[model samples]
Target: MRDIQHIEIPGHTLSVRVDPGPEREGRPALWPSVGEYPIYDPFLYTTMTTDDERNHRFRAALAHLAPDRRILDIGTGQDLLWAREGVQAGARHAVAIEVIEDAFHKAAANLPALESPDRITLLLGESTRLRFAPRADVCVAEIIGSLAGAEGAAAVLADARTRLLEPGGLVIPHRAVTLAAAVRLSDLLPEQPVAFAEAALPYLRSIFGWHGSPFDVRLRVENPPADALLSEGAPIEVLDFNGDLQTQQRTTTHLAITRSGLVDGVLTWLNLWCLPDEEPLDALSMKTNWATIYLPLFDSPVPVETGDVLELTFAAALSDDRVHPDYQLQAVLRTADGQQRRGSLISPHHGGAFRSHSLYRDLFPAG
Candidate 1:
């Protein structure tokens, strides 16, 4: 097979990506994070269900807290995962909420098969919109996004805190943070234009069509290379679901350039603590279902040396849909020579600019 493969879109022409580095070998399989989009299928759910690291930690937390407590499971999916697990873990009862119609129907079907099905209450609606009678003693959810709060965990859980859960109630996956570091795209792979694996094409088409047009969709790199980071990762956004949870927040963080290299963008990933005392499951280090996302800031890569400091301001707020958060990042690079360069990025979980950036333009060439 040729090193690069030419593909076709209805009104656009896609050319072959040039040779990437020899060590990289193949195109990285790419997928847009569909969680916030409310698109549920076995494709996404299977990953989480099979994620032993995620499951083990959550189960451990539930076993320690769910016994004899009234539990609430948000986004329980087709399998009613946490709700069923909660009942088995000795919870008095579990209320399972799912918004996706098909998944909710399947969850309804899955309910009667579980032992003591009456112990779980099934609700087919958004947790924020539905009313709870007596409130819950614990709440469990797996609504985490690739960017941590990108799925609106801060807002959704904050609502639970006010209405659905008891005061100081336990929230599984206690805290999550979005981590960022400087990375050179070429160094991450080869110098060639990036390519999507064959499996990613259908999902790409679906996503573009889902948005009614193509946009600068977030890129999810599967199994990122270990040596891609040029600076130590720093927390850009923090979501303490159990503590002072804020739906909208703007934070500025610093990353000291540890290695001299061309900085293309910030490579961000997730680090999650399922319980207060648990070790965080790191997306960058652990082989979990969570993938890393590359937020391209510079249309043209910037040159930097060791000792350079990158001051980054990251912002997140509700998008138009009001369920997911839109992300904006502004980065300023300050060098020892008093030279400074700036770059910025806007990645909305929903409707935004179409093929405006260089990367999107390259990926979806005009007719």
Candidate 2:
């Protein structure tokens, strides 16, 4: 490929190079235009750095490593902090892999200045496809998404367990769980159900059509009010990095309505367990980059009274694209007077498959 080329955006000009390879296929452009630095945002890195609980647990796990033990850090960002910390913690060798070219270069520049520079080997490639000489004693990767396994962590760690690590090797986060709870949404519309439904008319049309719902989004609410919670959170799915990858899981939980309120939908988050005995890191209330995922049920909130039982059955599966996961919730709410109401909420599931169909070929021809 050629060297860096300059291109202009709305505010400024940028220097960037287009990477021509299969790895870049189907991936969204890193910037607004062609000639812009890929993965240039520093806010995400800053958020991760400020997460003291996450950093402390990882450092504690690194402290358990003995001298001369090999460590593998997958998806190492610009700082290469995990690999550097491993080397400094008495690891004999540290292999850091970063796929993005710009981030890899930044990590390379920072690696040489680390405490044990000679012990770290920087590789510019994806960990899922790359192979190393010998198995590592410890494997660490921070590919976690909002949902615990939504970012293909289970698949990546499963592959690494068999191919990249030695027998009984340690994975930084050995266990993870996606937790969810019923929540009463703060009113977004001035009027009640009518206004909300009117606002969502466009989305409803798109969702039922050949395309999909553009409003399909995850919401992040920081420090929600106490009244927002309708029921206690329950674990939707549990993932073991060292064990089988749960591409699809079916679980059920019961939510008892604390008080009479209008419940909007379920709010979900992740819990990561770095050590066997240590407390799992919470994503809902923690100072981490991950935000609580809000899955709305209806256009407006559903009314419920105190002592209502919400029996929720959730079926979650990783999408075929291996990025976002699909979730289907079947809820049966029983009132105190023995009246039962059934409601179902499903995320965009078959839309991608429909878009790929031959009959719908013209809908997304460019794809």
Candidate 3:
């Protein structure tokens, strides 16, 4: 069977892996929805706007709490959905913040066209940097990244609590946590070489372009196999948006192997709750825009049977911009053979090293 396939058309030529099996088999492909680069695109906005799960939870929370209260909507995006929705829900007034200028301008131009536009205030700047008076009674920000706080939600929300919101004010998406587990990459894709789908190439280039170079940007896999997981997932990073929230964190968790298999990496996903008492939306189990992330640890596969232990160390810290996070993952696999296999990955939000790893090397081939 062919491991790879080439397809050519008039304007473009492409070579892609022949998916080992049908879609149910979980052939991994690169997708652009997971990262938080603050770049605005039409399709990306469409995904967020159309996500009924996200919309229902957020709208319900807003409708319930935003009434008769001033609202603060950070990263309001171009649609101004939350800000407008908050007003529609009976908010006294809503302050909408957008970091991307184009989006902010688009929102600025459109806010006036909507009903009760006079009650919405639009700002063009980072919510963390911009200051406003008479704090709101509710802060609604859907900036939670695929990896939870990967979008600077912790830092941004923490700042909101202290400066943007009134004391004891409500925060939408009350909590978010990152879950991780040991996985055998080959099981996810039998003998396929890791590569981006043709549709993903443009966005891949955009991510690299935004970062100034391909410096190990976070990789999100679409349609990962349920059986690919070698161990039960455990929470590695937890961000309590309405409570104690920190910008930097280091967490170590042990995942016990549940089956006999080879190990090479950890798969991580986000669990988020719009309110304290609500059920969380799990990325691994649900069909949200947030895709599960593959944090590759080992290049060479390590043999492991049931009862092996993989200790994973995950760290998230603010980069220079202080608006996005840089993530580092370290794994130590302890098996029955009395030997250990160790691997680590340093993923920065922006430039650190160009094409630093094998996956990246293949993503951006030699020119």
Each model's lDDT? 0.82, 0.64, 0.81
lDDT of 1 by residue, 267-309 (tens): 8999998889888999888878888888888888888888999
How many clashes show up per model?
Answer: 1, 0, 0
Task: Kindly report which residue stretches of model 2 are placed more than 4 angstroms away from their true locations once superposed.
Answer: 1-40, 187-215, 348-367
Query: Any idea what lDDT model 2 has?
Result: 0.64
| Cα lDDT over the full model 1 | 0.82
Q: What TM-score goes with each of the models?
A: 0.92, 0.74, 0.90
Residues forming the 10-long window of minimal summed lDDT in candidate 2: 28-37
RMSD of 1: 3.0
The predicted structure with the larger lDDT, 1 or 3, is 1
lDDT of 3: 0.81
- Of 2 and 3, the candidate ahead on lDDT is 3
Q: Which stretches of candidate 1 lie over 4 Å from their true place?
A: 1-28, 191-193
* Candidate 3: tens digits of C-alpha lDDT, residues 283-315: 888777888888778876778888889999999
Residue clash pairs of candidate 1: 21-190
State the number of backbone clashes in model 1. 1
